[model samples]
Target chain A: MVTTAAQKPILLSGNEAVALGALAAGVRFYAGYPITPSTEIAEVLAVELPKIGGKFIQMEDEIASMGAVIGASLAGSKSLTATSGPGFSLMQEHIGYAAMAEVPCVIVDVMRGGPSTGLPTKTSQADIMQAKYGSHGDYPSFALMPNSVLECYTLTIKAFNFSEKYRVPVILLSDEVIGHMRERVVLPDPATLEIINRKAPTEPREWYRHYPDKTTGIAPMASFGEGYRYHVTGLTHEEHGFDATSQEVAKLLEKFKNKEIRNTKELTMCESFCMEDAEICIFAAGSVARSARQAVRILREKGVKAGLLRPQLVWPFPKMPVEEVYDQVRFILVPEMNVGQLRKEVERLRTNMRVKVKGLNVLNSVMITAEQVVERVLQIDFRSGSESEGGTSNG
Target chain B: MADATNQTAEPVDRHSWLRGNKKFPHMWCPGCGLGTLLNTVIRVFVAKGYDKNETVVISGIGCTGRIPVYVDCNTLHTAHGRALTFATGVKLAKPNLKVIVFMGDGDAVAIGGNHFIHAARRNIDITAVVVNNSTYGMTGGQHSPTTPLGMKAPTAVTGNIDPPFDICNLAVAAGATFVARSTIFHYQQTFRLLSEALEHKGFSVLEVVSHCHTSFGRINKLGSHLDMLKQQRDHAVVFTPELDVEKARAEGKDLVIGLLKKDATRPEYCDQYEKLVIQPSQAKQNRGGV
Candidate 1:
């Protein structure tokens, strides 16, 4: 939001900012089951949503919450749900359903440690891979990762905007450290914020099709009782109310799902920190990015020429900024709370094996500190080129 | 087969709400009770004059769940057992819509029991049509939560040791504003109960006791689909508030059919939401609360 000057800076946690951001982004309905590190989001919305005449429902479980959110969105409400790793797993089926059905909604996964209930109330950026590939089958996703409280508020609004505009489910990956960490954020004027809403069909009711015969396959969705009388199912079907479609329709769908490349240039919400004339770079996102930035500054002061490539929008991978960093840098240091989940992704972009890529993975239910990253970078003997960290994902 | 696209309000006939022969031959086995359940539900919808546009028929994954696919209205076929949650969202978001959820016994109780009970507990303005077939027919006949004790299915080749849940009793106990039960054989009674259930304001659950005659019957040697229909007729007795169900056990009748309970005074979920949440905020905004 553009303002002559920002309003008074109010101290709010990352979770609080997310809750406020959802409201500002025109999210009118919320369905969720409370889970650790993400419960505050539900708690905040439960109190605030009712004040604005918005709907909030605590569903029986994570599965029900996801289902309800989709249902509410179909009936023409901007809906959202928040949960942690365990809950996110439960939501995978419905997430796939929303994508296949082309329903617009937002899901916030406040990252907590887990393969299965691994660590609650602990900070870990472990769910980066899960957010992209947890749900079976491909669906176009626009995900945002907020490293700070301010980014939490702004990126959340952007997440909703992208979700509505593209008619896809957007994910917000906020880790426990950032979710619980309080920061002074200057809240923007509501009027100044740019809010995007899902497109409505202008065609007559008699000619209405839930999925139109158009390229990109994005159709203007009608609310359930608004008299358009459309059909939605998880089944693969054609434009009309006909049952299932053949192989021809499946080929037409190739352009529709996960095809968010050239169109979403504005969605590359990554930042380059002190990368000018740097030989070493760090790739990180979410809470880990904060430490990476600090480590970059520390390395630069010591004349190491280190920089950081932080992906605020983790998916679609922010390729250009990464390529710019990768082309110039001699070594890429990826430090994260998880055991190198994102490091595997960075390795894929390595066109040159000469560029030493390594991850300082810490999965001890604690935040990766700036000092630890600085130590990891300083310990690297550049001339000898003796690498200790594994380079390949399979390795 | 003629294209069923944009057929504007044809004369109220059996084909009006149905997709007609377009989606046929229908997927169900010839003797499956799903056909009876579907026809009766459509009949009730027609008699009650439910505008197709203003209605949403949702279903979970089952032969019964296929009801939404065949109905010419706003239909949503969602995940198995989660239809109630989805229906809840649709109804709560827009109170004007009549949201009906159709689920099989396994879908409604086994995988979806938590949602089922809670939806009733909240007394939300949605009609739950639970077709209790006592088996998971879609996946071959397997013993479901409603499968009677000592009944045989593929999963329970030996007699089923697990006790079955009474769908109507579960709904009533879970605070459903209207609860009723009927078999596919009792066409008129099923239609009447379904019609009343749809008319009720709060959560209304109508349990249609159906049969997976091909699977359950063949395994248990219970004869054909006709024999299963005869069994539903013989086993069922009309439920009355004054009738002693314990006394009926002596008569060898276990199934209780008809309206078990209807409570009109309890506040419907949607109306309460409108009054408590919507009205207060509107008043505040009118008073320049913003």
Candidate 2:
């Protein structure tokens, strides 16, 4: 069915935008367990999916939900699942399985405060590392962080496109603030947006190899009921999807998939604000990015040259964008909800550049306000040579 | 492959239903009941004439989970204890596709208990083949949820104190449309139960009581697989009221076999969704109601 086109500037929360974005991306199936801050996405899809012949199931648990999403996608349905901290941890097992089997599906983790249900109704970006290293083994991960209601729609669409085209799992990292905040934005007509799907093999059934080696490093996928009768297992497998213990089979699943996904530079998107002639760069994402935007304006009005570099995708790390910030600014301050999570990624890319990176981290179950970021940036004495090498401050 | 007895004109083309001839000399140990169960499973698929393309077999992690690898059909080998959830998605996506799940006793009643009961409660159209070997054989003879009381294993070295589960009774209590139990020694009964499960419209579970002699038996001093099979064959009896009930109990056995429940009138999951959710939405759409 064609998409239900929209024209008006509708008021929608970030979670609601995600539900609509999934519909526009042609997601026909969603299996998820409702968790705090993310349940609205499930609620919206539960109401909307049936109107367009789509399927929505509230599974027994997060693990079952992730498993069901993979199964639906294998049966040729575009699928998605949404969850939060503890639930996201449960989904890591199947997330790794989807990576090895090369099943195209999306998982949205609306970040909440945690070390196991630390704060249910509060916001945090603590899942930054979990998005990449949560699951065992080496696999490719593409994570997109949306800072607003509008971006929640756009990036969820991008999430599906990347998951399908790369034949790998794509994670949409939505924090509690982005998931709950309501904003008025004109929704894009679904036809005007880009929607990419996995390429289907044109060859006959007998000649089909589920994971054929290609120069582009991605093989066409065939659905389960399409008479292909292919095998899919979590175990390491050769091209035809049968299990094998050889090193060649082990490298086949990880090597090419990582190369193809990481090489796609377009997947790593970053936004720059007020950096025409700036000295201090503010780095943040998701809810903190919105605060950083406001902090940039306050800093400029106060006669301090401050700019912002917000990365949309955090997995491939977007080193080029951060390097651009390093070249233009000698001091960088990262304000985030979690104490030194995304800040660690920024410091890791410290490179050989003689720049001072500091983090204004808050983990009090509250957001890092714009005033706190401005206060921390003003206090960073970049002239002190001893503190020039990467330092941190808890707000 | 074991030929089905007590039947007329059963399909004999077993090779056609199996994956490839190279996959033969399967990885199962000699005298393993899983192999016997697989042999009978293929015969049932052949006899029932299930399409290799449309029939999707899903399994969770364990020895029983590996059965999908040998079936020449659309197959999925999922994480431990998650096959029913996966099979639920497959059946919901394409209701016409035949979805079957193979799970071991531990994979079914232990780690997968929540999913197992929920799948039956939902009355989803998927047949679950739970091979109850009373132990986690793949993990080297750890006692499972179905391991008999006082049975010995590596995990239960001093003899298991935990009471065992009845797989069919669990399914029946969980609202499954069809439920049955039969030992591998009762080959004909097991064959019939599996065939019935495949054809059932809603959630159907056929608990095939198997013996892991290498694991569950050897540690308990139960001799070889043949001895275990002999014990099962001697104890198991068809559920019939006409038999001598007092005598059977005195001999240490009773009605422990045959179909426990079959209710065809219960509404199926996918059918209910189509009727209750889709039809009204489509009606609203046709009438120009947003």
Candidate 3:
């Protein structure tokens, strides 16, 4: 994993890489409560941010930290907060508010095992479902998971960009493995980064609608006092940001749900390896993506034409791209840290295609190894007979 | 009373900047003092020429929480008891914006009590107008932190054994830069006190004794909104600069109407944050641009 010195490489932990990413992306305000596997984010920012003329506040609790970050963002500062599972649960209400209010901010959930403080230092991807449905009510949220320390830096920057561009809270979903693991990350100069600020109103203040037309999907966000005095609430609201309690408002609310993720299929990113002519395609993300990649490589060595579809953007659930791959493959094998959470989504979308979706779920503390994934891929009953049976049919 | 007649009658010639949907008059019960407090806030906003665009009115869930929906400012109707938390975000995101929070007794002193105190302790630049009706008015008048002792409410059928909190005293103790208490009946005093609170640079709390005709009124046999207003008027006492803590305490359970404390020396949370985060050149950089 070594690179030339000209690449501006630095050895850093996942938390450090995240901090560096935020700093490089022009995040000037950070408010977070310290929690295991995520405390280093706040600790590092507390010292590094201040030196770089950024404000860092260690709030009394996770709720206040979320509140502070939201406040800082509304005040026209690029702001962020970091927390783990339990803290993420506490932040759900506000997170929903961020979605409804269209506030641009990043939330880094350095996940540890938990329904309630299960393993504070240990890793778990149990929050995958929570990230999608944790907040009550119907709304769309963006979540990105990074497997390595380098991806931690890259994805955090992406999180900020997505948040600002979409004007919604984007979750940088990292786990204990990446948050604690140290590796080399080549830091990009600030000038090389693409930072997206929220779109501002082109119309007059009086005419501006906080939630504009569904075409752009993103409305112009006028900061307070910029003359576009509009309303923002967690309730079902009209385009003007006023509380709208009518059938029309309900329709608009549905649009709010769809426009963010629906037609914009390109925003969904995933990595595919050896899928050009494969019979079995394994789907996975985050740490499991690493194992799936390795499994695909091992299967290729064993003369099995298996491929991997590793989603970088875990939600808006890559359904279309996944279905496209499903059309070409005889079987889809999905592996996850949790027990078949993503498998459910895949099965649902692949229904019309009649693709056989099998899941390799590892609920225990151990990571899903490449060997296990390869074994599972080989066992899949694709039209091409099982790899162990030495069948030559590519169907 | 003196200022009330003059200020209301000779209304400031400001634009009717309030964009609140009139169809939804308010969620507060008839005769609720929150209406009076809201009117006073509107008046202050008008008088000060505060641009509706720059003013953000945030409210938590409760009867009082509905106040922001009726205002024409950039409003945020946040989750229950989390207005301070959300308002903290709005204020920090736009430090130049004038942010205010409206909360009920329960929203401020019960579920949101921690945030209330911490926001004050940090001296965040936001005005919190706590409409203290002494019970959880929205949830059918459950006993709250401010529900008077021996008050018969649904949650306290045998009468509330717990002592009530003097919210103004609590705010003063928690380091609020400005603290005041006023009742709806004292229109002039309430308006003036709220105006001062809004104008204050640091965290300010104006705990207004509001009437909840539906719940608190029914149980206490407070007759009606008129009767409750009169009761508050009768029970309130004016505090002077010469009044000591002992003297104020001796007035006991009565609404002490006056600015209890003012500490302009404390640095506002936003000012401190700006100093820490914004570089000299960066501060001068155009907002919403790279």
lDDT of 1 by residue, A1-395 (tens): 21223587788999989998998898889999989999999988876677677898898899999999999999999999999999999998898888777788899999988879988889778888888888877666667899999888888899888778777888999989999999988988877889998888899997888876555545577888888877788776677645555764675366455356746577687788887788888888888889889888888888788888889898878877776677798888888887887788888887777887788888787888888888877766353278666532211
Name the better of 1 and 2 by TM-score. 2
State the lDDT of candidate 3 residue by residue for B80-181, as single tens digits.
Answer: 788888777667656778888999888998888899998889899999989888888877888899987899899899999989888988898899999988
Candidate 1 residue A352 C-alpha distance from true site, Å: 1.1
lDDT of 2 by residue, A198-306 (tens): 8999998888888886535567899988999788988888777777767767568556456446565776698889988988899999989988999899989999999
Candidate topping TM-score: 2
1 or 3, greater by lDDT: 1
C-alpha lDDT of all candidate models, in order: 0.83, 0.86, 0.78
Per-candidate DockQ versus the true complex?
Answer: 0.61, 0.80, 0.46
Best by DockQ: 2
- For each candidate, what is chain B's TM-score? 0.93, 0.93, 0.88
Fnat values, one per model, are 0.72, 0.79, 0.67
Any runs in candidate 2 off by more than 4 Å, and if so which?
A1-6, A256-262, A381-395, B1-12, B241-249, B288-290
Write down the RMSD of candidate 3 (Cα, Å). Answer: 5.3
Total clashes in model 1, counting residue pairs 3 or more apart in sequence or in different chains = 0
- Runs in model 1 with CA error above 4 Å? A1-6, A213-217, A241-243, A256-258, A262-264, A381-384, A391-395, B1-13, B278-290
Model 3 chain A lDDT-worst window of ten = A386-395
